[model samples]
Target: MKTAEGLKDIIKPENLVYRKSSLITDKPFSYCPGCGHGTTHRIIAEVIEEENLAENTIGVCPVGCSVLMYDFLDLDIQQAAHGRAPAVATAIKRLMPEKFVFTYQGDGDLAAIGTSETIHACNRGENILIVFINNGIYGMTGGQMAPTTLEGMKSSTSPYGRDVKMMGNPLKMTELVAMLPGTCYVTRQSVHTPAAVRKAKKAIKKAVGYQKKGMGTCFIEIVSNCPSGWKMTPVESNKWMEENMFAYYKPGDLKVPAESDADAENKNEQ
Candidate 1:
């Protein structure tokens, strides 16, 4: 409870240990108090700096919660139409192959309207990183059931919970995208806990590194918590996600390098 001048001595330059990412500007985040967007943003920024890709990195975002993500990142961000980010990213990456291109999209944006775009781009082997945040509902556009909405999960539109027989099954886009021959690496991660945060960051770093190496497309799905949309407190949302979301989505590597690379590494070790 001290003024700026009063705390100077106690908070000396050496006393400062950790700081926010420089890529994060003074612009305040518009995400809800406990939304995962901020944490995901910070993780991406740190990896961009750690991998020395901040300057050359280009980000594409489309309609939905991810549309505003550009406000938090300091890199060059392109705004695409609803479900059109993959097309924009494909163009950007193809024209300037040297630049590190990535897209930040939500389940509503990627799995719902942009499913075709996402599939075609990945199938073409576009060397870009796709950061997909699946909270299972449309957070920005009311709490409607999204493509990833779990079975029996209630939403504004699905007031009685999603019924498999009536609404069809929740789309597992990550697993579907993983089977594409163009995809080089695929992982499902979460940022709800400290340990999970570390793993998400590592996954991001690897995805970016893979792009730099011209490895095919990389898709990272973050099964995040949406407290407001889920009608739960931030803490409750985290717990709910762990219990329900993780059970269905299940965080882990969905796909990785082929056996050829493993054999080559084994020979090198020998």
Candidate 2:
């Protein structure tokens, strides 16, 4: 009886503004400290939960940090070979068209090795969501340079900074895929700040909604920061990303159904 009336204002509604999504498991994330993969995982899980897709949502993960999504989200997920997530996702979605299928891939897995699978999926208009995390460097494999690595950027493989003359230019894979007619929506976002996180969540939810309507491939690129790989603090990595990555990638919708692209952009503003 001592605790019956002891918590009058201790647990008010105001004190519980934000709580963890139910879709996330109790298992701790394995990403490095300050890794964007954790935030991205939370956002995707939140969207799937909010959309009531928790049961039918299936994730096709690749051979990178992105594969950890299975441990975080409480959904049916399958792993794919290096750069073959799209192909796997295609099969999953085709076999169960009623289910929402998505592919979680990193820059190295999607842009470099799985480039063909990703392109063909977009070109063929696979009705699936593609969450592409671009941290520039390959975080899982000892911080090597990735296809989306910035020009003149340094990595374990590029000790003296990326030499564009020798290595060509950093690939703008998002824009390249957006150019395909099969793609329905393509947006680049980040999760560094609260506002950016909100935008990314909206982008994810929209992609899920579109897929439910049997829409074409929806690609959402998250331009993220890699503190460990970039050799900077989390805050510094975010600052550097805004200064360098955003300048080249430019966060926004790269493509949409021409008739509805303008409308979609306007809604995002509202």
Candidate 3:
């Protein structure tokens, strides 16, 4: 076996192809082991680092599992009241137009109580990124049913599964936002696998780049898994999400800017 010093030269910077983002904190994540939140955080940090926005980026997080993100990312973070992240992010971006602003929200907060805030911000065409995580149930509050919970999905509150007749249908928030004219880009993605993570990271980078061009609202819904809330092992939760969550919240771009508009603008300039 090679000694520690003998291995140091082999692990030189020239040979390094991968490493954790410097924007990420040394503090361990409060999220549970195997949770997707950790991966999501890592990818976001990587995007900011790659874009060289570590000093200029601002993140807004509200209550629930999403709130702890401030501790994990070294960038400037502003905490908002539960379900009010979008509104807070709107103010930040408007006040500091030079800063890259984004909101990190969960389904329970964005699709339910903050529905108005989320809608208004997107409708007003806030030039900021909105990162929504949909775990179906309220992960931070004892697995209660959320507005995005699948029809017939069982939760602590919906012990027998959700009933569309009484409980109402699960809200496709991403699909709803895609129809809004103020939004320039919208998509649903997951981070359970390496390929999916790569796609998600790319989507995030694109959203950030759009802000520089003053594009309208950019939204990305991460169909994440909550093993603790779902009462399943991490592996089991991922499998279930693939079969059920993706069926309804299918992963793909829901909306993107029209090429004709860009073409017309270029023609006008010429």
**Could you tell me which residue pairs clash in candidate 3?**
none
The number of residue pairs in model 2 that clash at the backbone is 0
Model 1 lDDT, full chain set: 0.90
Model 1, span 1-270: residue lDDT tens: 468678877687788876788898889998887899889999999889877778899999999876877788899999999888889999999999999999999999999999999999999989999999999999998889998999999999999999999999999999999999999989999999999999999888778767877989999999998988999999999999999999999999998777785355346536
Every model's TM-score: 0.92, 0.93, 0.93
The C-alpha lDDT values of all candidates are 0.90, 0.90, 0.91
Off by over 4 Å in 3: 2-10, 260-270
Instruction: Kindly report which residue stretches of model 1 are placed more than 4 angstroms away from their true locations once superposed.
Output: 1-10, 259-270
TM-score of 3: 0.93
Candidate 1: TM-score? 0.92
Candidate 2 Cα lDDT to native = 0.90
How would you encode candidate 3's per-residue C-alpha lDDT over 1-270 as one tens digit per residue?
Answer: 569888888898899989999998899999876788889999999999998999999999998897988889999999999889989999999899999999999999999989999998999999999999999989988899999999999999999999999999999999998989899989899999999999999889878867888989999999999999999999999999999999999999898778875465446536
Clashing pairs in 2: none
